[model samples]
Target: DTAVSQTPKYLVTQMGNDKSIKCEQNLGHDTMYWYKQDSKKFLKIMFSYNNKELIINETVPNRFSPKSPDKAHLNLHINSLELGDSAVYFCASSQVAGGLADTQYFGPGTRLTVL
Candidate 1:
C-alpha cells in the first residue's frame, strides 16, 4: 500500500490551462500536505492541513488552492496554470506532531509542465 499517493506522475499543458493533482495517505495520518519543488530543487511547503487546521506558507501563489476533504487526503488545484507553476508537486503526510519532529513522507511526485 502507498503511504502517500498522487496520480498522473507527469502533466504537460499550455500556459493558461488549469489542472489538479490528487493525494491520499493510507497511513491513517491526521495531517497531510502539499509541497512544490522548483527547478532548483528547493522544496517549499505549500499547504498543510491537520484536523481542519490549514497552515499555508506565504510564498505559495494565490492561484493555487489545497483541498482536504478528510484527514487522510489532500488535493491541490491550480488555476490559470502559468509557466512558473511548472514544477514537481509532491504529496506528503505526518502522523501529527506530539512528541518529536515530524517526518514528512512524500509521494512519487507529479511533474507539471506548462509549455
Candidate 2:
C-alpha cells in the first residue's frame, strides 16, 4: 500500500550508458514530477506533468527526458549518462484540493551512480 514506488532503487553503471527509472503512484493524483537531488543535497525540479500533459520543464539537458504514461506514473530516461547525471532521482505527486495544492508525496528515490 505504498503511495509511491520506484524500481531498482539503486542503479550502478558506467558513463555513456543509457538508463531509465520507473515511478508509479497509487494516490490517484493528477500531477507527477521528476526531481534530482545533487551531491550537495540541492533539490531541483526537472519536469512536471499534469494529467499526462507536459507542464513545467526546467533548464535540464536534452539527455534527460521525463515521460508520464498516465496521471499516476512518471518515468525518467537518461541518455549517454555522464558523471554529472549521478544523483538521487525523486518522483513526486500532488493534487489540488479546495483551491489549495496538497503536499507532494515523494518516493524513496532512485540513486543513480555512474562510474
Candidate 3:
C-alpha cells in the first residue's frame, strides 16, 4: 500500500485559474509537509503541519494555502495561478520524536502547468 498519495497527479490550467491538490497519508504520522520543486529542481518547503496544527509556514506567497483537515490529510489550494507557479508539488508525512521529524514518506508529486 502507498504510504502517501496525492490526487490529480497532473494539473494543467491557465494563468488566472485556481486549482487544488489533495494528499493523504496512511502512515499514521503526526507531522506533514508540503514542498515545491521549481523548474531548476530546487526543492523548498512551503508548509508544515503537526497534529492538524500549522507549525511551519515558509516564505511562500499568500496565493498558496495549505489546509489539514486532520492529521491524515492535507490539501493545497492555489489561487490566481501564474506561469511561475508551474512546478512539482510534493506531500510528505513523518513521525515526530524528540521534537524532531523522523523519516518522511513522500507522495507521488503533482505536476502543475500554467499556460
Candidate 4:
C-alpha cells in the first residue's frame, strides 16, 4: 500500500493565482508535515501537525498555509503564486522519536511551476 500520497503530481500555473495541494498518509503515525524543496534540492520543513495540532516552521512564508482535518491528512494552500514558489512540495510524517532516531518518509511530491 502507498504510505504517503499527494495529488497533482505536476502543477503549472500563472503568477498571482491561488492554488492548493492535498496530501494523505496511511502510516497511522501521530505526526504529519509539509516540506518544500527548492531548485537547489534543499528540503525544508514548512509545517507539522500531530493529532490535529499545528507546529509552524519559522522560515516558511506567510503565503503558505497548512491544514489537517484529521490525523491522516495534511494539505498545503498557497496564495499569490510567484516564480519563487516554483518548487517541489512534499508531505511527510513521523513519530516524535522521543530521543531516538526518526526518518521522515516523503511523498512523490507536487511539482508546482509558476510563470
Candidate 5:
C-alpha cells in the first residue's frame, strides 16, 4: 500500500488560474511537508505542518498555500498561477525524532504545467 498519495498526478493549466492539490498519508505521522521540484531538478520545501500547525518556508511566495485539516492530510492551493510555477509538487510525511523531525516519506509527485 502507498504510504503517501496525491490527487491529479498531472495538471495542465493556463497562467493566472488557480489550482489545488490534495495529499494524504497513511503513515500515522504528525508532521507533513510540501515540496516543489523545479525543471532544473532542484527540490525545495514550500511548507510544513506539524500536528496541523503551519510552518512556511520564507522564500515561498504568497501564492502558494498549504492547509492541513488534520495530521494525515495536507493540501496545497496556488493562486494566480504563473508560468514559473510549473513544477513537480511532492507531499511528504515524517515523525519527530529526538526533538526534530525524522526522515520523510514522500508521495508520488503531481506535475503541474502552466501555459
Candidate 6:
C-alpha cells in the first residue's frame, strides 16, 4: 500500500493558468511538506505543515499556496502559473522528533508542464 499519494501524476497547462495538486498520507504523521524540483533536479522546500498548522513557509512567490484541511492531507495551489513553475512537485510526510523530521515518506510527485 502506498503510504503517500498524489493525484494527477502528470499535469500540462498553459502559462498563466492556475492549478492545484492534492496529496494524502496514511502514515499518521503530524508533519507534511511540499518540495519543488526544478528541471536541474534541485529540490527546494516550499512549505511545511504540522498538525494542520503552517509551520514553515519558504521564499516561494505569493502565488503558491499550501493548504491543509487535516493532518493527513496537504494540498498545493498555484495561481497564475508561470513557465518557471514547470517542474516536479513532491509531497512528503514525517513525524517530528526533537524538532527534526524523521523517516519522511514522499509521494510519487506531480509533474507540471507550463507551455
Could you give the candidate ranking by TM-score, starting with the highest?
Answer: 5, 1, 6, 3, 4, 2
lDDT of candidate 6 vs native?
A: 0.89
lDDT of each: 0.87, 0.86, 0.88, 0.86, 0.90, 0.89
**Which sections of candidate 6 miss by over 4 Å?**
97-101
Which prediction has the highest lDDT against the true structure?
A: 5
Candidate 6 residue-wise lDDT at 32: 90
Clashing pairs in 6: none
Cα lDDT tens digits, model 6, 53-110, are 6755557999999988888899999999999999999999888821343787899999
lDDT score, candidate 1, position 14: 93
What tens-digit string does per-residue lDDT give for candidate 3 at 1-115? 9999999899999999989999999988888888999989998888888765675555799999888888899999999999999999999888872134378789999999999
Q: Flag regions of model 3 displaced more than 4 Å.
A: 97-101
TM-score of 5: 0.94
What's the distance in Å from true for residue 102, model 5?
1.5
Would you list the rank order by lDDT, best first?
A: 5, 6, 3, 1, 4, 2
User: Candidate 2, which segments miss by more than 4 Å at Cα?
Assistant: 97-100
**lDDT by residue for model 2 over 61-101, one digit each (tens)?**
98988877777788899999999889999998888521126
Residues 20-44 of candidate 4 have per-residue lDDT tens digits of 9999889887888888899999988
Colliding pairs, model 2: none
| Superposition-based RMSD of candidate 2 using all C-alpha atoms, in angstroms | 2.3
lDDT of 1 by residue, 1-115 (tens): 8889998899999988888899999998888888899999998888888888888889888899998877778999999989889899999898864222777888999999999
Scored against the true structure, residue 40 in model 1 reaches a CA lDDT of 100
